[model samples]
Target: MSIVDTSQKQRGRGVLEGAFQVLDALSRFPDGAGLSQLSRACELPKATTFRLLEQLVELGAVQRHGTEYSVGHLMARLGENWQPHPRLRRASRGPIRTLARLSTAAIAVTILDGDRVRVVGATRGTPGELPHVMADSASVSRTAAGQVLLASQPRRERPEAYTATEWRRLRSRLRQDDAVVVEYEDVLPGVCCVAAPAPLPDGQGVASVSALIIGSTVPSALPGLVLRAAGEISRGLAVH
Candidate 1:
């Protein structure tokens, strides 16, 4: 009997193996990794590593900074938008609803999308009345998630490049640790939000989980609930 050719199978596995190697190399240096570093870490030839890195960059999964590469924010946005991993939602969504139900508030999950953050998921407390929701990529009012997520960012990250109006809007949302807990900037009128960042494996915040309780609702429990959810998410993603 003739044996089937295993060369094609090996090649297919080789492609994925090389990709994973590149990612692993990039993960080691959160700031970014140069071609040489990636090649050494992956134990692959420089030419081979470069080829893989170039492909990853073009896919928007990795960003090249000068001679180095960093895990691009675009990838985070995509993951938050539609991660096949249930652990993320399991660790976050239930807690979000817990907060919303606690104050009968609306809850929102947002992720940074390029220049602005976009709402990926939301749960409203009551029927008929919808929570404030603006179009995608617009500046959302400061809330729990924004504050925590932004605060989770590096202090040096600049928000000054935006337009005067945009700058003012973003600045207004800024908080301790660069957090942005905004009022009804654009989404959810008559609701005040409290935000915090959901921690990720590499000190990166995966998303902003915020609670938007009715302006008239007492905020006594809102803060604790949001913070608790943030904690849970952080702990859950500790291994990421």
Candidate 2:
């Protein structure tokens, strides 16, 4: 391509990236987010963020209400047709609900998505005890479910939150024991989570089932309960 053409293409690519970043950041604010909040979240200049938001609103991918913006009906319509892991979500639904009921802990089924973990299905134990991380997406380094999925990955693919030696030891223990338990003081003080890998028919671990204990005391049997639920989901996926 000509030099001018190439420069135009690069600028177009940059704008596209910026737009998607804005959308991703907007997803974190379900109700709505003001321009300054979104700009900071997306790490884009306020003017640039506003320009992108205007374009997105024009295309119906975003909606604006005075100074706040949120995802629009058009995006919702598009999302309705997109199913990331249909079989996995369907197979885990029953086990997730059962686990939540039995343990009285919030339960989630998550799958690795690049360096992040996406919650495919979730059930609340009580009316208002859900963790914020139980949302649609979370960082791989911050969640027990993410750790279970990361343990199944090759060393090079793991996140840098753990040192090499630490990762090796933790991965081995997690794999051998078939579960991992962690407490997150930053995400939510006094919350603990137990996660176990859900394997496929060929014995490849692809997803995880996690139970979030909301109180200070994590039940001694919670890890085993999560492991059982993960196994049940794996069995269901095997036949699906």
Superposed on all Cα atoms, the candidates' RMSDs to the truth, in angstroms, are: 12.8, 7.1
Tens digits of per-residue lDDT, candidate 1, 1-240, equal 123457777787998899988887887787887899889999999999999988888888799889988887766686445643345655666677777777687777666544355554467432111234421223432344543444345552433323557544454544334343545434566666777666556554457777765674446666667767767766766654
Candidate 2, lDDT over the whole model: 0.78
22-86 per-residue lDDT for model 2 (tens digits): 99999999999999999999999999999999999999999999999999989999987665577
RMSD of candidate 1 to the truth, in angstroms, is 12.8
lDDT of 1: 0.63
- List candidate 1 stretches off by more than 4 Å: 1-81, 84-86, 116-121, 124-138, 141-144, 155-157, 160-188, 216-218
Q: Which candidate is the best by TM-score?
A: 2
* Candidate 2 Cα errors over 4 Å, as ranges: 1-75, 125-140, 155-158, 184-187, 201-205
lDDT of each: 0.63, 0.78
